[model samples]
Target: MLDQKLFRHPETLSALSDSLARRGFALEVNRISALENHRAELQSKTEQLQAKRNETSQQIGIIKAQGGDIQPLLDEVAGLGDALKIDQAQLHDVQEQLQAIYLSIPNVLDDSVPDGDSEDDNVESHRWGELRHFEFTPKAHPDLDKIGLDFESAAKISGARFAVLKGGLARLHRAIAQFMLDVQTQYHGYTEVYVPYLVSGEAMRGTGQLPKFEADLFKIEGKVAGDQDFYLIPTSEVPVTNLARDSIFDEQDLPQKYVAQTPCFRSEAGSHGRDVRGLIRQHQFEKVELIQFTKPEDSFDALESMREHAEAILQKLKLPYRVVTLCSGDIGFSASKTYDLEVWLPGQGQYREISSVSNTLDFQARRMKARYKNKQTGKTAFIHTLNGSGLAVGRTLVAIIENYQEADGSITVPEALRPYMNGMERIQL
Candidate 1:
């Protein structure tokens, strides 16, 4: 949330409008300005009416004390009360309208973010390792249906865009998550957390996933009657970040780092016929999420460190990948800037995104009221928030399957994962 003054302050609104324009977001400058004007008028009217009502009541008391007729004064007070109610209600409506506009506006882009309109326009920061060369035609993860990657059973149970991993495949999936959690917590300086899979609507809004991306989420109604319920978490970032919501920490607690593994559920509402065949896009997937709360001055550095934490996972597993800086237009709603790590997939003959690390700056912090008191200034300010996929577990598994597949239809376990696999060297049907 922006400071409300941005909509009305003469010196700030123009600069804010231009910044939003650069990001391809249109700001209703005129409408917001008009609404703010009306709000001011209505609020002034309300205050005046309230004062008149109080003054009339005081006059009535004086008339009664003098043993004089008080009916006329009583009547004036009644009229004042009615007028005050109307003015107050109008003021309330105008305030709500202004708030709605504020919430819908996207964050202003950072000056360093490149101007572009889509993923194709994103700038490549760098690439790591070489794309694997295959001896035979590589099979996509879905085509290697044996060893427990079964779509048929998954479809029968839950319809399309779903899969069921069994036996060795299921074990491998679990291992990927465990390995990621270890890398994030033990090596990356993140505290491990177990967050609720379901969270309140406010939690979703705080993370910039609601009132705009609600269709992309799965909302669960209360099991009983007439109950307003919770939303299934689309990412652990929602719940974990909300931990700092409405909270103020000491400056010493400046950087709070957290990691969690959770089953994310998404409706994938607007995506139709895209990545429709495999785990590339799914209704349900597992992810190891990393979140950080840092001082405003340190946020950009924190974003770089967080991205490296994600890249370390792919590097350790020997996966080929590239990093791209998301253009202003392609960045997520809450993020001021973002870096996406796309892992090379031999089976697909392309690089697919495995993680996105973003620095939301103070955008999300303002929304959730997450703050820290600065000891030197004796003032409180919003803490900057950052989040990333320490790596999407399912996609990492897909990369491993295709990159390490043997001509004999067996899958070689990445050495880093061998211990988690109980020293099992490979999986074969």
Candidate 2:
């Protein structure tokens, strides 16, 4: 959401052009220039017409006051009014066209971001702990036989991409969410929040979810219990990050930390074939989201701290994981830079992302108009926004099931969660 005026300015445009080009987004400079030219022309014509109409109206008033035939002045004023109307219409058209271009223009990526197209191109920053070498062949998660958990039954009850965890399994899932929330709020300096599961289109747009990824949301059909076009939230981050929308904050309160556990829902329309068997991907899952609002200078520090906060959960649980920096194209629409914490999943025989931490800079804050005032300059500026999954609750469960599995088919509950699980050390079925 860089200013359109800056894109038009020669010096600013050159720096922006170089930054975007390095990040692999060939800025549509020509199209933007054409739209800007049309807007400039239309605005000039509108201003001139408005000035002429005002002067002619004053002349008509004077003629009528003088008791003279006002037809000639009236006719001239009427022609000016018509021209003004035409100018107004053209102004409206050109403004709309310019706005369309502005809205579509993406934020320039950070130079630190690696140039790549997909998840595979992301850089592996660092990894912790070693994978346990099992003497027996590891079984896939769907083949888990000891636990009463059944994905097939879940599918039968609620179609594909659903999961059913009854008895101890349900308790364990809840325990994981509580554990993540506790660590984030109590240890990591995040204020806990409980947000609405449903949100408006504006909230989604503020987070860069609409227009491009409408297929991934569960939009409520028709009118709900109340009159509103609400979408089931895909993440708690949507509401939490939007807390500062259209508001200004004090500089002292610059970095705001928020943590929330909510049930997230996603249609995930495009991921039709992948992870079809278990909790690796699901329609509804619980998550503890971490969101931060900070000054531009403090954003990168916030990013690393958020990543470590996510890693702390796994480390406490004794789950092996690695941190990775997401490449340019693989990063989300609003993220200038991102880090993903991928926990080791023995069942999948590879690392899978359990949390994604991103420093969005001012991209989302600008879109949401969230800002803070500099006391010295008396100027309000967009705050940098960052959000990360402390851990995706359902995927954490999957990782635990896979990574902490025993050769005998029973699952060992991670030590950190044992206290939450009533001192239980294993799930023996």
Superposition TM-score, candidate 2 onto the true structure: 0.92
Question: How would you encode candidate 1's per-residue C-alpha lDDT over 1-429 as one tens digit per residue?
Answer: 777877787568888998888778888988988899899899888888888888889888888999999999888988988888888888999999988888898887777888899999899999998877787998988888666788889999999989999888899999999999998888879999999998988899898897899899998888533576789999999999999999999999979999999999999998997999878999999999999999999999999999999999999999999999999889888888999999999888899999999999888888899999999999999999999999899999999999999887789999999999999889977
Task: Name the lDDT value of residue 243 in candidate 2.
Answer: 93
- Residue-level lDDT tens digits of model 2 in 1-429: 666677666677777877776556777777777777777888888888788878878887898899988898788878888888887888898788776655655667777889887889999998998788888887767788777677778778889888888766777899999999899888999999989999888898888776567889999865775677889999998999889899899999878999999999998898979888888888999999999999999999998899899999998988899888998778877788889999998877889999999988888887799999988899999899999999999888888888887899878888888889999888867
TM-scores of all models?
0.95, 0.92
Worst lDDT run of 10 residues, candidate 1, spans: 220-229
Clashes of each: 0, 0
RMSD of each: 1.8, 2.3
Score candidate 1 by lDDT.
Answer: 0.91
Q: Give stretches of model 1 more than 4 Å off.
A: 55-73, 224-226
Question: What C-alpha lDDT values do all the predictions have?
Answer: 0.91, 0.85
